[model samples]
Target: MDNDISKLKIERQPLLATPRKSRHLGRWIGIGIAVLVVTGIGFSMANRPTSVQLTSVTQAYPSQAITVLNATGYVVAQRKASIASKATGRLEWLGVREGSTVKAGELIARLENADLKANVAQAAANIDVARARLQEARAELQDASRAHDRALDLKQQNFISNAELDQVKARLDRAKATVAGAQSGIGAAAAGTEAAKVAVANTEIRAPFDGVILTKNANVGDVVAPFSSSAEAKAAVVTMADLSTLEVEADVAESSIGKVKVGMPCEIQLDALPDVRLKGVVASQVPSVDRSKATVMFKIRFVEKSDRVLPEMSAKVAFLERELTSHERTPKMAVNPAALAGDGKEATLWQIVDGKLKRVPVQRGEKLGDLQTISGPVKIGDKVISKPTDHLKEGGAAVVAEK
Candidate 1:
């Protein structure tokens, strides 16, 4: 019976919804999918980190080493002299020019000393004549003494009159007086000759100490004088300085003067030779302050002097509590100065943590090379925003730029 019913049937069921309703349902489904797609895109954007360039904080001992102060100065010579002649005369010879080395008592130059030499010669001849006169007077005095003795014997023996004996004694007295005068003349002549010899010696100019000539102010045939009022007159023969006594005279800020002390270890750098780093020590601090500049002068002596170094070259001094080791001189535990913000009294840094920038306060210390010392929430290996911008905010996600 079931087989016969299946053969008789076959009517189609009515559509569940009208064609418009089906269209409406399709439209709503598409709207929901579009909304879901946009929501996913927003979520993805929120999870993304910000794009930023980063710099790493260094870890090194040199940055942490104590740097007491920094000052600008120039290289100077401690023992410098402007050599000049003591008397007015034409320069006949010049032994040293610029960069010539000289020793103490070395003859550097000579003057026109012909007149002085003549004076010396004349004085010597006078001394000889005076001595001859003195000798002749002494011979006469001896003769007079013998004559007076004979006269006394004659008077005692009553062989001669008293008047004649008195006359002989008077003659002896006059001869003795002449001998004394001649002796005095010899002494005066000797003194005059010595004075003339000294005058001749003064015509030769000599070096006061061992040093190298820095400048040749006067040349051969130049007129040298003790005090030069005329432009042509040369006051100094040469400007010389003891190279061994070279020192750096730095001008330290008066406010920071307390940080500097005599014998402090220091590092010296010259502008002419930028690659060299010279070791030095604080030699002294000037007692007075420069009121106009508001600075104090300090001197630094080189530990190992270099032949390349010269006086008057520009230099910089870094005074330290102790000498810096080879490694400590390198950058360590430091960050780029640009990474620091809110400068002056207090400084802040934007240190990255978990891919986000975090504001942290730090104590700014002396500059190490181009990097600065920062004692704050940051540590070695920590990434910091280099050249932080206004868009970079605290706790904001930051993405480090790829090199």
Candidate 2:
């Protein structure tokens, strides 16, 4: 029985030893997998790109000489005027409002001048009364002259005293003086009547020029006074501006004022109209400079009429240093800015030669738009890596892929 117990203990020991050896084999397998994963990660990190992938474009670009002048200003009207009443009265009617186009001598508004009308009637009546008085004085003077003639004849025949003839002559002269005074009074009345008529006519306001009304200061039923010191009196009935005489007023720095002169070509861009570029010429350069702003104001007139342009519109002016040549306006060959590296001094690019990266040196020219002009030892059909990795050295094997 003791020998049988020893044999069972030995069998249990072998079974326990077999489980320990299997555990050790499983640990070695886990360690090998972990090492392979680390090696793969290190290789991927070493082959990663140094910079981000960028798109490269090869196309034509401009290489012309361009001078950029930064300037800002506003559009203004050259011919602007304010419409106001010429006589004091209540505004009865307004024929035009703001933004209304009017021609010269066109009625803009009318005033109710009751007092002026009455004065005109009174002057007309006085003129008639003065005419009647002059007629009566003339008749009396004729009658006196006739009587003096009879008296003179009687004196010549010795039938009357010398005193009687002298009295008749004196009466004739006095009647003639009374008629002269009545005639002078008639002339004065006629002048007063004409003046009253003129005052009544002045009550009606008219446009002095053909232009668009910008502002309407006085409305219907508002009292308008001519040449008043009060705030309301100083106000204009309507403000009008000529759209045809629109001009751009640009504030150019004092340093650049010397380059600008009258008759120089200018390109104007309105904030309201973005797609359109209007041509203009420097009309005049103001002699004086604005000391506070340290700038000189220049006036530019549009060469062509534009219906879209208005007074006081915001605009940007570009004063071209030189006109573009025919070839410069045309397109030229260019490549992506990212394709060429360095401060444009030494351009470096990666070219694919037989499925391997080949570093190539290139010469670059002026940048045009988003692409730059490149010229050197590179062909058009050759593929270039837009974003190259540090591991992608010359003669290095590479696999081409599309982004």
RMSD of each: 13.9, 8.5
RMSD of 1: 13.9
**What tens digits encode model 2's per-residue C-alpha lDDT throughout 1-403?**
3666655664444454567889899999999999999999998876653333434445542422343464789999988887777777778899997778899899999899788989999999999999999999999999999999999889989999988988999999999999999999999999999999999889888888899999898888877887654666534788898888899999999988878888877777799986556777889989998999999999999986698998888998877665545565455556777776666457777776666667888778777656677777765545577765555577665665545
Which 10 consecutive positions of candidate 1 have the poorest summed lDDT? 59-68
Number of backbone collisions per candidate: 4, 4
lDDT score, residue 353, model 1? Answer: 76
**TM-score of candidate 2 to 2 decimals:** 0.69
Off by over 4 Å in 2: 1-21, 24-68, 231-234, 321-403
Q: Model 2 — which ten-residue stretch has the worst lDDT?
A: 59-68
Q: List clashing residue pairs in candidate 1.
A: 58-333, 60-332, 60-333, 62-328
**TM-score top scorer:** 2
